[model samples]
Every structure is written in structure tokens, then in C-alpha cells.
Target: MVHTFSGNPLDREDAGRRDDVWIDTARDDDSTRFLALADLNVPIEGESLHWLHREHFDESDLESALLLGSEEGAARFVVDLSNESASADRYVDARSAATFLSMEDAGVVAHARSLVDWHRRNRFCGRCASPLIPKRGGNVLQCGQCEANLFPRTDPVAIMVIVDGDRCLLGQSSGRMARSNFYSALAGFIDQGESIEEAVRREVMEEGGVRVGDVRYHSSQPWPFPSSLMIGCHGLAETTEISIDEKEMNDVRWFSREEVLAALAEESDVLRIPGRMAIAHHLIHDWATGTIEV
Candidate 1:
């Protein structure tokens, strides 16, 4: 199934992008399409990206445009319009845009946002504090002084629904969801030298004080909120004790299959989980409805 940002239809010509000649030609080509982002907000019209031509942007602006991929032999690029003032209504944040965009369009936007944001944040070398230059169609960032090659990094986060008999473990973080009933799958970044199962067990134990014995892979989603690959999983709980880490979570509890079903159907005021846009929703729905055996 094509999740929100999972099915990007771009042909990221890996070998072709490495050649400067082809990259330069594509940048100036009249047929090349560009998607603009102002402060990471996508420009949209009638639920579609407002694509611009090469002529619309200055030569300097085109130099920094990231090569998203190729479509029908035409290069698709994304450029940041943060310096240029635009109408607020014409643009929407990537998260909100995903709600209305097609799977392919949302994938493109996610790709653009993650790559552009990476470039914006890593303008300088981490080792030498020197300026970094974009290379290989903006895929690689080479430092001028230190000559360090940096690539875009995607953080792996383990999100799982821990099962305990007829109940599943879910939590609300200490921010926006703290005041609401919205609870999602327990998640945390996979450590530098940790496996997906290890991360799932660690996160569940840390957040909800639950001991997980068996872990099974569910699915993965490209969550581009500053570039994160959410590794979804299902875990079998060995213990059913609740101990909330007050700093990280507002509340963590086990919800029954009946209650979860009610919430998923929007008939329960006591609990609410994420919609189809999130991998957590699928994880919860599948378990509650017996779509998967954990």
C-alpha cells in the first residue's frame, strides 16, 4: 500500500546526476519543472503543487534548486522561496498538505522538504567550520576547506503498538496531545548501534514501563518532519504495568480492543488515535480489528 509519503514517482537518476554536464543542462532546460517552498511551506492550488518554470527564477536561484527526480525525461526540481515574500494562503505546511495531496504528490513534497531542510541546516562543515558546497544534483555536500562529503541523513524511529492480551499500549507526549485524548504508538529514535527490535523494546519499557518479549515488523513510513524513517512494529508484552516518564509523556496506558475500535470509528470521546496518514493508525487498526496476529 502507498502510504502518504511512501510512493514517490520520481526517477532519481543516480548515475546521470553525478555528471556536471547533465546537471547543468537540466538546470537551465526550458522543460524542467520547479516546485517552490517558502519557509518550507508548499505552494498549492486546488490540491496540486503550483509548479513553476525555469524562467520564473533567477540564475542564482536556479543554482540552489534541488533535483528531486526526472519525470518523462524532464527534470523536476524544488527551490526554496524563503527570501521572496508570498501570500500565506497560497502555501501550506508539508504536514497539512499531506492530508489533501495524492500519495505521489505528498511523497514529492516530503522528499523536497527533507532535502531542502537538510541543505538549509548544513551550510557549514561540521569538522572545519567551513562553507559546504552542493554537488551531485544537491545530493552531496562537500566542504570547501576540509573536503568532507556529507550526505542527507534519515533518522530511523521505532514506532510500535505493544499488545497485552486484548489491549494495546499507547501514549500521549507532553506537548499538544497532553491536553487532548490523542494517543499514538510508542516511538523513539533507533540508537546508533541498535536493532529495530531492541529500539522497540527499549522505547516501550522507557515510556510505559512495559516489558516486551517478541517484536514483529509491521511496516515503515517516510516521516519527513526534518527527515525521519518510522519503522513500525508490533510487540508482545510480557508485563502489563504502567509507569509513565513524566518528562517524556503525559500519559501512557493500555486500551481495550472495544475502546480502540470505538475511537477508530470516531464514536469514543474517551480515546482518539491518529488517522490513516500515520503508520500508528494502521498499527492500531490492524491489531484492534484482528487484521494481523501478533
Candidate 2:
């Protein structure tokens, strides 16, 4: 149950796979809408979310564009205006942009950001170091020098809620923007060929020296910081003592349910977890409500 962009109901028809009339018709049709991005900054109109129509800009202004999908007989596209800095009315962080947008709007913006970032980073073929062209309606890149089609990739990460008796393990990463000691669930990227469950167990063991006994799958979230699929889970820990990985986290400790509940019920100076927008927050919320235990 990825909360962000995954639940999209739109039909993302592959431009390479089908010969649908709508695909061609969408390009010229007035219903075709465009979400413009300039250096990863999404355009926000007033209060409600809005996208630019093809009428809004000259064709030359579009540095790159991708066919996102279609909904309700209309096609939606995302264009990177990173080459055109003058188009932005006011620049805003794309991550913060998704925070208050409507579900449908947020979903599209998230997809747009992910695709644009993929395209931006992969301008050249890894094999030949030659320029790559957009293919499959911008879902993939192809090298003209060689017949290779490179596709967008999403990294898989495991985020866990680990419990030992009445206490839960949470950590504050040194990589965080602030050192206010706001803690969240332990997370790590899944190694190649590793299952989500294995990743959860290994990450917990490595980061906090907590041997996980039971691992249960929870809901997931699409964290589109670049692109990552967060697999959420609940873990029962066999060991209570923590051995902090100083390199990975600034602080690691076990907090009782009472302590977490207090923070969840109200804002506090001592601790803060991620907000409602993150799956980590939901994982902590569920634990606070006695939804899961060791």
C-alpha cells in the first residue's frame, strides 16, 4: 500500500507498445496538460494545484518532455524546463510541493519528478558514453551508437518498526538536516538479490545490534526523493541492548511505549518522529496504538 504516487488510477500507456489513437490525439488535443519543472522545482498555482497547457509556452522552451499518462480521456505530460530558468514565478522544493497537493495532483507531480530526475541523470549510455535518446514515451533511454535501451530504476528500501517488550528501537541519523534528535524507523537500501524481510532483519542487526525474531509486513510508501519504494514492516527483537552504528546514526536508543505515546499525542521538546506524510510516522503511530508488539 504505497501512499504516494503508486495508487494512481491513470493509464500510463507505453508509447512504444501500442498504436492507440489517443496517444497521437493527446499531443494535439486541448485536454493535454503539462506539468513543468525547472531544476526540480514544481510550479504551484495560488492555492489549488494547476499545470500549464501547451498554450502556455513556445515549443522551443521545452528542453525535454515525457508522456506521463492519461486520465478521463485526457493525456498528462511532464516537461523539464530546467534549461529555462525564467519561467518560474517562484521556485519551491518539489518534496515540499507534494505535501499539501491533492491526491491526484500529488501523484502526477511525484511521477513527474521521478521521471525527470531519471532522464536528467541518464543522459549518456553507461556502455558507450554516447548520448541517449528518450524512448518508450520517455520511460526509457536508447543509445544511437548501440542498440541498447536503458530503463528507469527504483531503489528498494526496508523501513522497520522494531519492538522488544514495551520499548521500541528508533534512531536519529547523522545525515539528517537537523540534530534535534527527531527519530524514525531504521531503514536501509536492499542489497542485490536480498528479500525485503532479509533486508529488515539485517539492517536492524547491523545498525542497532538487535537480533530480529519475527518480521511482519506492513504497508509501503513511494518515497520519490529521486525514487525509492519503502517496504514497511514490524519486527520483534530478541535482544534489548543497543549497539549504535556511529557511522550510520548520530543517536540510537530504546524508548518505551509510554514515552512514544506522549510524543505522538502532542508535540514535545525531547523527541519528534516523522510527520503523517511518511510511512515511518504511520509505523510509529501503529506501534503507539498497540497495533503490534513483540
Candidate 3:
């Protein structure tokens, strides 16, 4: 199943965006629409996104706006209004905004947020510490002195639920989840030269102190808190001993099918899990509900 931030419908004009003339024309086009984001927050009106026109911004603003994509032959771009004094009420945090936004809109906003944030953070070249200029409609950052090109990157994270018989392993991380009393599937970033299956097994062992075997891929989600691709999986546990990593986790334990079901339904006071917005929810729900067996 495609997750919340995975179904962007806009046509990311890859070839056309490479041309400087085409980008200028599109930015000047009357039909072009720009999504204005302030402090990485998205603008919302009622139940939908509040898109602004090109005329609302000056030439300097339009110059830095990143071309997101096109819909129905009209150009679409995203501009960061972090420096401007925008009304706070009209904007909502991207994480909270996704709950009310349409799946397609959420995907577009995810793309915009990640792209704009990357540009904001990568203004200088890493190789030579020179200023990097935007190219290919802000998709590529080119270093002027070194003549090197850099592109935005999405980090991969492995999130999995390890199962043994009728019970599944879940963990509460050290800080936020510990305070809120929420448990989620153990997750960690994929390391360099590490395969997804290897990462899953390693992470399970490290965080939950349970050895995992026979990993299976389930689904993936685009997490745009500065851009991450969450790879979800299900695994069979070879051991059930709990020795939670004190530095990383507050608690890690195995819960029965009944416990997880009640938690998914929001009927359990002792256990709480993330909502549908997270892929971890699907991983746990699918396994506990017998939708997928490990």
C-alpha cells in the first residue's frame, strides 16, 4: 500500500526543468502556482492547502523558489518564507498538517518541505566550502569555484516488527516515547555498506536484545522530516530475551496479539502506539491482526 507521503501526483518535469529558459518562462507564467511555507510550516485554508500566485512574491523571492512540479499543464513551485512575517494562524506544522491534507497534497507538501529545507541547509559546498548555486530548478546545487554538483538526498531507515509465536517486539525510545508512554517498532538508519535485511537484524538485536531471522519486506513510506525513506519489514525472532539498550531505549518487550490489537484500537490505557501517519503503525497492525505472518 502507498503511504501518506508516497503518492505525489504532480509531474516533476525532469527534462524541462534542466533548461534555464524554460524555468524562467514557467516562473513568469500567469498560471503558475507557488506554495508558500513559513518556518517550514505549510499554509492551510479550511481543509485544503492555501497556494499563492507568482504576483504575491517579488523577483528576488521567485528567483529562489524551487520548482516542485506541474499539474494540468500549470507550473507549481515552492518558496520558503522563513524570513518574512507571515500570519501564524494560516500555517500549520507539516507533521500536523498531513492529518487533514489529502494524501496527494501531503505528498506534495512532503516533497516541498524536504527540497526547501535541503536548500536552506546546503548553501555552501562541502568539498571546498564555496557558495553553491541552484541549478535545474533548485534540484541541483552547483559549486561555483570547484564546479561540483550536489543533489538532495533521502536517508533510508529500517523499521521492523519482530515476531515470535503470537507475540511481537516493540520498544519505547529514550526521550519522547518514554515520556508519552508510546511504543513503536524499533528503527534505525541504514549504515553505509549495510543491506536492508542486515540493518533490520542488527537493529533488532541492538535495541531489543532479540535476534531476528528470516526478514521480509512489507511496504515503504516517505518521511520528510528533512527527508527519509522508511523501509518497513517483518521478521521472525529466534530469541525472546529482553535486554533493552539503556542508552537508546527506555523499554523493550514482547506483547501478545491481544495487547497489540487493543492498542491499535485505542482501547488500552497501558499501551499506546503511533497513529496511521507512521509506517510503524501499519507494520505492527498487520502482524498483530494476522494480515501478514512472519
Estimate every model's Cα lDDT from 0 to 1. Answer: 0.92, 0.79, 0.92
Instruction: List TM-scores for all candidates, in order.
Output: 0.97, 0.92, 0.97
Which 10-residue window of candidate 2 scores lowest in summed lDDT? 15-24
Give Cα distance to truth, residue 264, candidate 3, Å. 1.4
Candidate 1 wrongly placed segments (more than 4 Å): 86-89
What is the Cα-based lDDT of residue 78 in candidate 3? Answer: 95
Return the TM-score for candidate 1, rounded to 2 decimals: 0.97
Clashes of 1: 0
RMSD of each: 1.3, 2.2, 1.2
Q: List the residue pairs that clash in candidate 2.
A: none
Instruction: Please write out the lDDT profile of model 3 over residues 43-139, one tens digit for every residue.
Output: 9988778888888888888999999989999999999998997643589999999998999999998999999999989989899999999999999
Compared with the true structure, what per-residue lDDT tens digits does model 1 show for residues 1-294?
Answer: 457898999999898789999998998888899998999999998888888888788887798888988999999999988898753359999999999998999999989999999998998999999999999999999999989999998999999999999999999999876968889999999998999999999999899898999999989999999999999999999999899998999999889999999999999999999999999999999999999998
> Cα deviation in Å at residue 28, candidate 1?
1.8
The weakest ten consecutive residues by lDDT in model 3 span: 85-94
In model 2, what lDDT does residue 121 have? 90
